[model samples]
Target chain A: MPIGFRAFALAGTLFAATLPAFSGTLDEVRKRGNLVCGVSMGLLGFSEQKPDGSWTGFDVDFCRALAAVIFDDPKKVTFQPLSALDRFDALKAGKIDILSRNSTWTLEREAGLGLLFAGVNFYDGQGFMIRRDNKAVSALELNRTRVCVQAGTTNAQGASEFFSTNSITAELKTFPDGPSTLRGFETGECDVMTADNSGLFAERLRLARASEAVILPDIVSKEPLGPVVRNDDVRWYTLVRWVNFALINAEELGVTSSNVTEAKRSTKPDVRRFVGVDGADLGPKLGVTADWAARAVAAVGNYGEIYDRNVGSKSRLGIPRGLNQLWTEGGILYAPPIR
Target chain B: MMVSAYPALLIRVGIPAILVLLLGGCGTTIDEGVVTPGALTERPATIRNEQLIGKWGVASYRDEKDRKRVEAQARAQCRLPYIIAKGPSDGVMMHLADDAKLYELRIKGGSDGKTYLGPEAPPGEWQDREILSVTDREMIMRFVDPEVHGRYGTFIYVRCPG
Candidate 1:
């Protein structure tokens, strides 16, 4: 066979193999040489740009975890900052390999749109906030309160449901994005600003005084956030999904980036299998080398490490591992068996 | 001639004291007598004077100034487990199920799809006995009591969706 004929044959085979995933992210990503992941524009603990332009956050860590499984180096990932409205379209167009922002898992987003959620990275809900000066103890007390929310998010719809459900009528103020919504809240232009609990903490750090605002106790909706990829990419989906599982499992196994290499020497079978030390070869099962899990573990430790480092009790964001804790630890962090 | 461990000693002692002084007010005041990881665990979460967390910047409310505003910046300042999915006695819950961990009243961002730290009220010597309620977007709490200043005060917050 001539070299030209051989090259042509290879290209034809590649195309045929990916016919189902054509115009999808699986092919484009492999061709591009890097996995492009969509992240929040700048939410501090979930996905935010460091002053040096590097990305950091729980969501960012998930992206790196996915990259590690693919390229054997988590840093192979290229982060793309996407706004709340643009994240979905970017993934739909194959502009990004995955959407790992703190986006909620909703029925409309899952089925209505051409997207699929891998797993819930964070379990959050919606609530209200007000000034301490106001004696408004509850969302029920606001007879004529003005609410500020994002225009296209579930927050918009949830706000409508909350007020109507409680028979409380008030003004609804929608904004273009998170920053403007926060600014409006700061300037006293809106009474309540609504979004994810994680975003609220990051936004609050920008305030002149951290005491003026108060969150209310009314979780009107559920926001189970996770990574999203275009539909019909089982290879990419399994790779991404398992990488997340690895993180959560790592956390459960107590293997952190700072100490996983040392801990890999453990004699425990589960530990050996998890860190690729034992005969367990789970990585090759996912289209990567058997050491894929090890590479991910080395690069980012486990889910607990990622959470604690990114949004857990020790980071600047310093959120506790509440519902995100492993099921063994009494939280809801269950994953499929590695076997 | 001025080279000495004396300067090093001063740096070692002075730096920490300054750090203590500056950060002292940021957290709850302590005895200034003992410190340890165990001690840190024993200390209760606290919110200090006028230093505010972000406001719940979602809805429209008429203020005394008659200013109609949306609450967007309501946020959390203290470390978590303040409002939790599990109980403090249980430490950190590993399962996503243990809502029994009432670390937060309800620190959530409401459906408008806003993400916020719902609400959390940790018990303290100078804290509120009842953390009233918690939601995903905001918190309603009261300190010890009107006489105690640690009761009957609520904190509402909203998290920005990243």
Candidate 2:
């Protein structure tokens, strides 16, 4: 056999060897008694571990919602913080059942890797941050300015493309990582910092003079972030996807944690279906109890409540619900109906 | 055209009464809380209300394979036609997402030059469904709300042969 053919054969063997068995992940999660969720190492508002060894943030709450659906207990889950390089590998190896990290859903990631994104949980994009003192309102005004971005990330490429396309002549400065990049921006080494808009909000809070920094309104790239599950198990995938949709639909239907109980008594067909008073077969189709959505909503509240609690207007980050709001309100966040 | 003018007059007199009925009938208002009132458009609907009065075979699909299959399926559904009844006003009777009962929705013309079917609210509102294409034989429509669109997909309405 030729060298290329031999290499191909070897690669095929390795791929088959690494391929997980077709065992249903939902069964495994139930048998294990806890859902092992993969999250970011330490990105505030998205995911971060407190000194008390408890995890909390937007991503963490999503996992908790999953737990609520399955076990009827929001705390019946383990948070495994994974680095960007290892997150997919960890998921593929079956170390984690679900990755609720703020991972962007892309064509390459879905097709190249044998994983699937459940659904877009957050609509994010590349953005710039500047000091309020500079008084620059838009990224179009950043010509001749110095921009600091982390090396070997999509943000750097996004910033490059945006500036070139718009004919803005700005100096591009690269740092080793997020901390160093923020340090560069803080120490006057760069005039503006670029990252995912969510990261910009999270990082701005880290600044000593956080109130002095402002994230611009311009979005340079689409970064739709969602939960990830391995493609081998359709049942588990459907469960996760519906959990997300349930949260979003609950918000749309005005079923909050405070009023989900009252909503159970609602005569409206949609509300009745959502709270499991009607369409009892819907949850069974997903291999769960009839009132799965209700349990999840009663535990974590709806998507809006979870968002506000973690990263939106009620949080310390105070990130406005620009694209995260319900499609009815003004944003693109939409979910499929339960029925 | 005179038939269309009569319904327009009825709409002017009938819509507020229907709104009041909807508001009063439901103990728990599902859609009223979140929908922010906006300026209603003045653009005339491209498709007239009279055009949708007959029966249609309706089916929806999310993927291409399903689209081809559902087009034929929609045509077959003409055996038990989905009636598009004339409303009490200048609208047609239709169902919104998860609606137990049909509603009298207006054929609103948007500033973007698209025709929409929804309640007498803003065009492209959550309850609205955009009319993608329409002809004497068939019509295609989809929900403006992403959630509804994700679930129900695009609907094809094939006109039932007389």
Candidate 3:
């Protein structure tokens, strides 16, 4: 065989060898008496540690929703905070059952890493942030400027594509992680910083002089962040995917935590189906209790509630629900029917 | 539209008495703490244009985390003044000096017998707020859609008499 073919064959063998030696992650989670969730070390609104050392944010709520469905208790889960470099490793090595970190779902990550992205929870894109005093309205004006970016991230590729397409040549100051990258930009090591728009907003809060910087209007690349699970765990993958869809469907159907009990009594066919009051066996299909979706909603509320609380207009980030809103509301978020 | 019919039925039964009470032209005030007889239902109260036509300042805007950073930004921008003006139809228009476009909102009666200020577009397009109290000196509003915008809680606006 040719060299290229030999290399491909070897990679295929390695991939097959790395497939989970054990089946049914759900079973293991049950035996352990708690689900292990992997999350970011700290990113405000998405996932962050409170003063009391408790976890909170959009991503954190997702894990709680999963736990609610499985154990009927949102607190029956433990969070293992991991940095960007180790998050995937932790998930692949079985140290975590579900990775609810704000990881971008990409073809390489899903196919190459032998992992599956359940669904996009937060729709994001890359953007730039500069000093407010710069008075630059457009990103094109940043020619010959220095940009602070984290290495080993899509930010590096996105920045390169943006600068090249805009025909601007600037120095790229790279750091190992998010904190160092933000620090470099804060200390004047770079004129601008680039990251997912959501991340830039979160990191801005950590700046000593946060009021001095402004995120630009330009969004250059797509970043659909979601939960990731091991490949071939068909039952587990289906369960995770449906939990996300249930939350989204709850938002569309107006079945919030505060009114879920009332919603269960709704005469609407859609609401009844989602609330498990229409005699649908959705939970049985997913290997959970009959009121799985209802419990999840009661535990963490619906997708809209979670978003508003953690990242939307109601959150410290004040990030608008632009592309994250439901399709009926002019956004791309849509879920298949439960029926 | 189907859900709207319920509110219309409520209006026929409740508005006459409230309108009679407000004929004095002092503007109707609905204290959120006081539950009116009609408040047994969930219909919103109707607000008159006279109550909202004035200049106001931003007192605060809270988020889920209750951080005050964005509120401070809004406060600085309000220094230019926020104005509520009469618009075409029953809709009211607000123009924040810094914003380029006019925001059109409508006052509707809720089952709670409280007036709410919601966007002029279709329902669920944007979050609505109840006019908890509106006076010559101060006005308070609370988000009607708690599931979507409740983290902001009640927004307080003091009359900017300058």
Candidate 4:
């Protein structure tokens, strides 16, 4: 019976890890002593693990930001690499505290699956990438083009919809995953490839000649990518949402990791409150600490810092802050005020 | 104390203004005082005396390429640190970091605590940028073009060190 009891306990722990996000994800994450974040399986600028076993990328930094708020240490995050298909199931089953993978926040995923999208961290859209010499100026110009699309993704459906809507005949070559799709595209199995524009850019680099491929400026569908938590825990949801907003607002307020120390000492009332120097106790309300936002910025920098370093002009992905920018800016990335 | 209420007031005032402009538009002439979001009715010939007349450091930016690398590229191009300046008659002049190529941008202020900056053109001639925030040392702005907005969000610029 000694071994039997141990076996059951181990099984219970494993089972608990896969349960739905219910009750207190906060308490569970705290007790476990680390925040488990579900990330994509190495999407270059979005989330990738270096040879040193340390993770870096936009999504990875987001998790680190969350961990910094919770534990005051970005290293406290455990990045669990998940595939696009499995990422949501992982979050839903409580295998991860947060889903930082570049997941599209869809109505079905949110309202139907009991998951809540905190906010769009990255606003992406489906687009077509083709050979620059192909002379197709727009998606409409892509008539009768052979397209490579990944299977089991919205990109496949989107490609089909675009072709149909535009009344263009398309030969869609479906691949099992991103790498395969890129391989197909690289080998000229298809004349065009479709995915979230960011993914297309990431995949383009894997090709033999990156410059040969050009992502069409036209975008077809809206893909509001962001972190997701279960709807069961409103407090946890609020905290996660605010963490993203904090990063965004921090950037808008001109707070960067390098200047966060100076920002904390800012005489401006807005800066003081934003940096948690003179704000009402907010951490306690989120089941963390009042200085949680400060810690997060100190660890991972602001949203723009994270963006530039990972996906924006700094990283190889070099995705623009288009619709992802704040509403005040030309982009639609408007976050509610922290107060 | 009232300074803290600016954002909320902006939303309150800006929303109605935007709705009114949107609904009233069918081909209204610029002379009707149609206060569109980025369409300034009064176009100045020179930068003159505007609030945006100084060097601004690039705090953050986003585009189709890596922002930090772009910044580094810009730094390599500039004689001084990356900065946007407002010169008389030339509007706001921003120097590209690497080539130090100067771009003259037109700028105007709104009653809603917002500013517009873009190419040197008459009011409503071209899509101007919307400067969302500007303080003693900080400036946050974005292009007013929906296409550009859909591509790169707003940019945050800090006042350059003296």
Provide the lowest-lDDT 10-residue window in model 4 chain A: A1-10
Ranking by lDDT: 2, 3, 4, 1
lDDT (10s digit) by residue, model 2, range A1-339: 122332243342233334344536776678778899999998767887988888888899899999999999999999999999999877877778899999999988888887899999899999999998998999999999999999999899999999999999999999999999999999999999999999899899789988789999888899999999988778899999999999999999999999999998998999999989899999999999989999999998999988887887667777888888999998999898889
* Positional deviation of residue A224's Cα in model 1 after best superposition, in angstroms: 2.1
DockQ preference between candidates 3 and 4, better one: 3
Per-residue error (Å), model 4, residue A172:
4.1
| Model 2 CA deviation exceeding 4 Å by range | A1-23, B1-162
Candidate 3 local distance difference test against the native: 0.78
For model 4, residues B1-162, the per-residue Cα lDDT tens digits are 001111221123578666755554333446634336444455333333255666655544566466556445443433455445655565667632223566776666544545566555544332566666667755566665454454555565555556
TM-score of 2: 0.63
Worst 10 residues of 2 chain A by lDDT: A1-10
Q: Model 1 off-target regions past 4 Å?
A: A1-33, A84-86, A132-153, A163-184, A187-192, A216-218, A328-330, B1-162
Of 1 and 3, which scores higher on TM-score? 3
| Better lDDT candidate (1, 2) | 2
Compute the interface RMSD for candidate 4.
16.7
| Cα distance off (Å), candidate 3, residue A70 | 1.4
Model 3 C-alpha lDDT per residue in residues B1-162, reported as the tens digit of each score = 001011221133478666645552134234432223333333434558778877776654555354255345444555666788887877779632224888777776655555667565332222456677877766777654443332454566666655
**Fnat of all models, as shown:** 0.00, 0.00, 0.00, 0.00
In model 2, the clashing pairs are A335-B147
Model 4, range A202-224, lDDT digits (tens) per residue?
78868888878888878899988
lDDT of 1 by residue, B1-162 (tens): 111121221133578676755554235444742122112112322322111233333222224232212233233333222322343442322211113433322222222322222223222222223333445555444333233222212333344332
Model 4 misplacement above 4 A: A1-23, A134-137, A167-180, A187-189, B1-162
DockQ value for model 2: 0.01
Whole-model lDDT, model 1: 0.62
Model 4, residue A196: distance off in Å is 1.9
